[model samples]
Target: MTNQLVPTSGSPERGIIVPVPHQRPEHFDAETQERLNRVDDAAFEAIAEGRPENTVTAYGQDWAAWEKFCAETSVPVLGVTPGTLVWFVEWLWEQPGKKAGTYTAPSTIARRVTGVTVSARVDHKVKLEEGVARPARARLTQLKNELAKTRETRGRGKAPALKIPHLQLISAALPDNLRGIRDRALMLIHFSIAGREHELAWLRNRHITRTDEGLVVDVAVSKNHPRIVGIPYGTRLATCPVRNWDAWKTAVEELTGEPVDPDEFAFRRIHAKGKSLMAGGITPEAVGDVITRCGEIAGLDIRLTGHSPRRGFATEAVKKGKEREAKRQGGWSKTSRAFEEYVEEAGIFEENALHGIGL
Candidate 1:
């Protein structure tokens, strides 16, 4: 029989139709609706909260190390047991050093363990109950406490502070070449700006602006803080950052056969033989190496790192009786504990008020 809707009054002879209730289709086109259905909102949010590139790279390395150790010991990769963590902590503590006189520092061990713990908890989704977690925590805590006690007698081997005299020596010792000019500019700018290694590495020519006063650098991002600050031309032309910067820019322009673009990296690698400049900017590691090599040339018997310039700026400011200004200029937070240490180092012998008492 042909289907027909019946009237609600049920008069069979009259063929009045009653419409059946049906859900309406969505208004979106087929392709657009399908795309919307395919989107994983949770995944998008996870991606949005992702860490920095360097941090991700380090996590990859740390996870790899943990996996390798677990594989060798025939332990569960995804379900890491409390006993496995204890053994890993032991291995971290007693791991053989790459050099004869060195072993893994306590801080390094702590970082590795932290990385592994995060990987287990987040990546593997390992959830431990109180019974396992309590003992695991106890073991790790005991190990860390023991390590700290053993290291109590040792000194913190920080990078040696570079002063103006040291800078002058290092600058003078550089060979008179393209590399020399570049290094000179890098050193002077690093010392003057008091910027961290990554900030220096990421600098573009566009970030610098020249005014009647001097050159100002806009640090787009720094360690924990970012801002704009001016670094003025020094009275001592020999070690002036602005002069060195101009000389470097001129040299680069001559080599490239064009004016340097604003977006171009401020610093680039030089060929070891000093024949030509490399295409891209130098790494933070290379920046640290430059300071170390310069220190060797200047006959500084202490180890130097990338932090030397930033620390040097603070120390110099302290010595010049500009502690407050130095703290502000160096981008240190108001609650920073490091201010006292730099101040003490600056005034230990020369600027101390107690020296007049002559005890």
Candidate 2:
């Protein structure tokens, strides 16, 4: 049947049809509309508040993941509940790939979960202020509860600490030639200084100063604080610089095959096959790989990494400090967590026992 255009009750019957007024789409409910606007506002506010790019990127990725999950599950944003969040966490946990598609370490997962919970709580607060009825609780508390449940479902895994012998073995395994010497020196410096890999990588030749008394390393940047570390005249390492600075000077010169410039890296790149040196500094990954190779050479059946030297240094220094002025030479900050770790490793009573026993 052909459709006829009938006149409305308010219009004259001249067969003149009037256009219908446009209505907003029904897909966006009042709550959903509010949430969509809030999301846009929050994003703008986040940027305006000067949030770091990395942090903003992480949040964007996380929220995008949430939206994807919701769309797949046919869940509405305004209908999100704590139970929905729990399910989302489970979905994330069960995802295929390393660490269940999260690509995050355990500590990283913990941190990210905390962030998600915080975002949810913030959204919940916005809803509540808009007359949505719900009791408010801290996001941390919610995260802790969810984490406990998740852990209960998925059994905890153990992570092993790096071993010192493994590190020594790695060092021993490197070709005992020029590269070997450089690797050994690098390892020794890493352990002796207990420095971060980046700090070591960025270390310049001028940072190391030799005087009539001793050698001192001026650490321009550090985790806790910037400070100078000195090797006094009497120590074994000190003699190379204090008693005869030329020994270190000559060793460095021989390694580099040129007069070492003050602006050059303390450890310059040397070609494995030849004596030719490169101007650029070594990366942390290269340093770690070299250490791993050293472990293999030493015939040690354990894993090792660049960080081993720093941990080993802290362990050894704590042990050596028991009888002598233990705290003085390490150059550790009074408030540093390393101090606590060192003390824990070097038991106070065990240190006092030698003093108690008469020779």
The 0-to-1 C-alpha lDDT of every candidate, in the order given, reads: 0.75, 0.56
The TM-score between candidate 2 and the true structure equals 0.51
> Per-candidate RMSD vs. true structure?
10.4, 14.3
Estimate TM-scores for all models: 0.74, 0.51
lDDT of 2 by residue, 165-203 (tens): 444445445554556666665665665566656556767
User: How many collisions per candidate?
Assistant: 0, 6
* Candidate 1 lDDT over residue span 25-98, tens digit each: 46678887667645644444465356554455556777786787778777777656667777766666566555
Q: For model 1, what is the C-alpha lDDT against the true structure?
A: 0.75
Off by over 4 Å in 1: 1-50, 72-75, 79-89, 96-100, 117-156, 350-354, 357-359
Off by over 4 Å in 2: 1-103, 109-176, 232-252, 255-257, 272-274, 322-335, 348-359
